[model samples]
Target: MTMLEGVTTRPGGRRPGATRTRVDILAAAQRSFAEHGYVLTTIRGVARAAGVDPALVLQFFGSKDGLFDAALRDDPPVRALVTLAGEGDPSDLGPRLAARYLELWEDPHTGPRMLAVVRAATAAPSASAMVTAFMTDEVMLPLARAIGADQAELRAALTGAYLFGVASARYVLGVAPLAALDREAAVTYVAPVVQHHLTGDLTPP
Candidate 1:
């Protein structure tokens, strides 16, 4: 089965209109946050987009913040990343991690959610905290400790910084050349840096 298959599902066989309305509001909120950004997107705007009352948006999500959190909460990439760290050979972790990271972003099913978090995090403190906490607790530290790296936390932090820089430049900023490169080519260029961070000695040679 596809890695992103279980992240979300179609609202099977048409349930109650209230249930469907909640789903519609959530979908609209995601699109609004992705397109207009968190600050500019409002509950009223989402309600208008979803063809529901602003009160209905609050009825389902409590607040705009709550809706935003719900929209981004089902991140499949994190699960995939943890699994990759656990299942792969230590020596190949850097390259494999880089490849998988790009794969998740490039995929249609997962890419928007990835971008939404990355983009929204820049403009919203709460989003930034959520991303940072996830990276530290769920990804970087775990991977570093799993591989028995020295200064594991530092290595993890640097790794996250490096990966996020690449992602931001290529995917978010639309930087020339980097953004234009194919996924494999980008991985080849960046993987060694990741490998060095993952396994190479950090001390001066």
Candidate 2:
């Protein structure tokens, strides 16, 4: 018998078609979450966007929270931030990190996903906890430790707060001159503050 004749597909097997369908659903979910945030996005809406039955979406991800968790974990900009935290000279880490963080927000492809995560964190407790854990445990803590900073956790937290505040003001709230500033000028203003948070002394006078 030919090789193909001897092989039979088993029931419930993970075929290529099933994998493609899953991927399509995930892409739809990402877009939905990005456009609508966690509180507003729904399994049925994502299913409709993917052109699949709502049951299939539920089958793949179990629940709306599960899908949101997956989307957060799969986010490229977050991954990029984590990767950046480990690279380059500690002295210049501030500007590099600042530039990259801003670039992700500016890029049309990644901007929506980043905006979704931030907005969802503000709107939903579950999303907030997940994002807080990821940012602190995965990205900031390691970077602080890698730089041999004392009070690493506190340093990491401060750095995160500064960056988050900047992003929220400029992108989310569209506040004043900050929102209007060009990328380079914003970076120039932000880099030093980030540098101090990461490496400067924190002891009170």
Candidate 3:
């Protein structure tokens, strides 16, 4: 189960009579993201799986990069994660957000896949676009809202830099000192930054 999501959900697949002609291609890309990890997956393989003309996939998504971007929007962590945040106090949002974010990263199945995608995205245009799109659409939107801030878009992007950086260093790259620290240690240090981002600093006792 992802963060706050039930595991029973499955892709509805293409709508009937849709024949957008690119449906198969999209499905193929989805599987590729899961099986081969983003780095090893290829547009050619996706084309082959779809059993359509390889050029069709290219024409539809514009590039492997374009397909990757679409994938994030299509299948994202937002629904569940947001569900977890439902009806919660805005001021105390930091730890909940941090906990959910960390939970996703720590998940065994999702973690490896996510890690693979992140690694693959580092150099791949398609993968990079996918990563950027997910962060913008899912994580950033609610993060801005939880804080009751205007310019949610900007706040979201700023929060992205902080969160993604920590995820990469601690979970992905496994920085020595940070890796050694416990989750509580992380929550204590990390939550304050999230707190500031969501609810800006003000004079206090």
Off by over 4 Å in 3: 1-24, 34-39, 125-130, 182-184, 202-205
What does the lDDT come to for candidate 3? 0.68
Error of 2 at 60 (Å): 3.6
Candidate 1 residue-wise lDDT, 12-96, digit = tens? 3433598787877787777777667778889888877777778878988898778887776645365567676678688888889
**Candidate with more favorable, higher lDDT: 1 or 3:** 1
* Backbone clashes in model 1, listed as residue pairs: none
Candidate 3 lDDT by residue in tens digits, 1-205: 3221222222334433335556666766766776676776687777766666667678788876777776656655543555544558777777877777777777865675567567766767756766876776776777577556766776677667787788889987899898778887887778778767666643354
Report every candidate's CA lDDT: 0.79, 0.82, 0.68
Candidate 1 TM-score, C-alpha based? 0.74
Q: Weakest 10 consecutive residues, lDDT, candidate 1? A: 2-11
Residue-by-residue lDDT tens digits, candidate 2, 104-187: 899988888889889988998988988887788777888888888899999889988889889999999999999999999999
Clashes counted in candidate 2 amount to 0
Among all windows of 10 consecutive residues in model 3, the one with the lowest summed lDDT is 1-10
